[model samples]
Target: MSTATNANELKITRVYDAPVRAVWEAWTDPAQVAQWWGPRGFTITTHSKDLRPGGHWSYTMHGPDGTDYENKTLYYEVEECARLVYDHGGNDDRPPLFRVTVLFSESDGKTTMDMTMTLPSPEAAAETAKFIKKAGGNGTWDRLAEYIDKTQSGRESFFITRSFRAPIDVLFAMWTEPGHFSQWLAPAGFTMEFHDADIRPGGSTFYSMTNGQLTMYGRAEYQEIEKPSRIVYTQQFCDEQGNVSRHPLAPVWPETMRTEVLFTSEGPNETRVTVRWEPCGEVKPEEIEVFKQARGGMTQGWTGSFDKLEAKIAGSQE
Candidate 1:
């Protein structure tokens, strides 16, 4: 992801496994868009769509709690699968909140989507960003990834992203260095301790986390480590002696999960972290279903961990 140079703009970028044409179709087709457009738990009803310059799209987003949000988008530019420029978040009662520019590019059979949302002012942009986070708007892109994955390969995965105001190297170290990692990797109310620490390609670690009442052990085997950019590992629950085991509380959980973490420099002193998680080796259908059903819980847990990570970064700077 690239940082927005304009203070009034918010930028986001994501790469999908699908090709450019497939991704373009997913975004342009009303039926496909409806499958993964809004935040999780929310659905939309498209009253009309006119995909051309000077045309408009009208839709109503239905909230999980029965509330409905009407939206109107006016298109200014449309370049087949290359780019789109439009005004978003407007309705009959008010003007548009921001202008959106989206660019699509492909390399090595993967499609990269870059989006910029420009608000009226920097304050408005900041406020909107906060509101989006609180409303789980980021999940919309994650859902898109899931949709593409299911369409292309009959597989399921989980995705999450967060941006922190810290240097890329510092953020990367927090993930690779055992001390810094243990300080913030555990969920809220739990403390982590690394019994065996080795973080590198082909290396592994055994750790335990406890919330005073109960303790759980886990192991991670690192498969790849690209300095300050990417890390791939496989994680599994285990006993105190490091013997592989099923989740203590959720037996239906997959035994092993492959996690890929990508770190991108958004600015001189900021980094955006994106995580992709999927079942590793053989996985049963029941386990996959359980994983799909527990996405909400997974989001909450990861959010709590990120909060702690932010605090730790702040403390380090101070």
Candidate 2:
């Protein structure tokens, strides 16, 4: 597979405000790719897709202007969550189109995708450029970003998964136990002060997080806890006395949220943790809007917290 792009090839690169795995999955998974693979107002129907080397992927893209384009791709190389080299063209005995190499990389919790399409010749590149410009290729990327953000369908759920170089039990204890949990739970620039922490099912926790000038209090009721497996909790904004209250910064936000975290062992000393957060209880329209608006910031907050948690785990191992 060619890793470098030539000057004559068509190259497009975009850095998505999302994780590497999420972005890679959207590009490789046929079901997910169909959601945003085509141009604006276009729908894709996949006939077959095989993601391995030498495999073939066939699909029909229907345009908003009542045109149908048949596409087929032969996978030359596939690297999980990293690179894909494929040759794509028209199906049904039609001539080949171009060879594309897409590379995925991550830095600071975000993903950058670089795609290069090399046509057969300069004439072919010129002809394809016209079609790409007329079809609005940038719109397809925007659609992809929207698809990744709305992954859980209509639900305003935030999901993130990360791998840790620590055992599942160690990670579980660090997450549930009071002192260790507080040490790395808060986002960057914030410090947590726990008033109470009861770690078992039916137990509750109340904490205040301060960032120099501002302080926010939160309470959580543990609904379910399975050691080294999963934890479900109900979280809400609260006052110093633990009285339920709207968020100090976003009064229109939901008062309560349901959070679920799953821990899975990848190896003897490796673990993968997945977190899902969703607003619960009676959510007003304005509250929903607030939640939607806060999604980006919330993701950034979690990413920062996880970065600290990773460092904490590494230090403890030493």
TM-score top scorer: 1
lDDT of 2 by residue, 88-207 (tens): 775768866888888999999778788889987767777787687555554566557657767735566655556677889999998899999999899899999789999899999999
Tens digits of per-residue lDDT for model 1 on 149-203?
A: 8889888998888888998999899999999999999999999999999999999
Best model number under lDDT: 1
Model 1, residue 187: C-alpha shift (Å): 1.1
RMSD of model 2 against the true structure: 12.0
Model 2 vs. true fold: TM: 0.60
lDDT of 1: 0.92
- For each candidate, how many residue pairs have backbone atoms clashing (under 3 Å)? 0, 0
Q: Tell me the lDDT of model 2 at 175.
A: 82
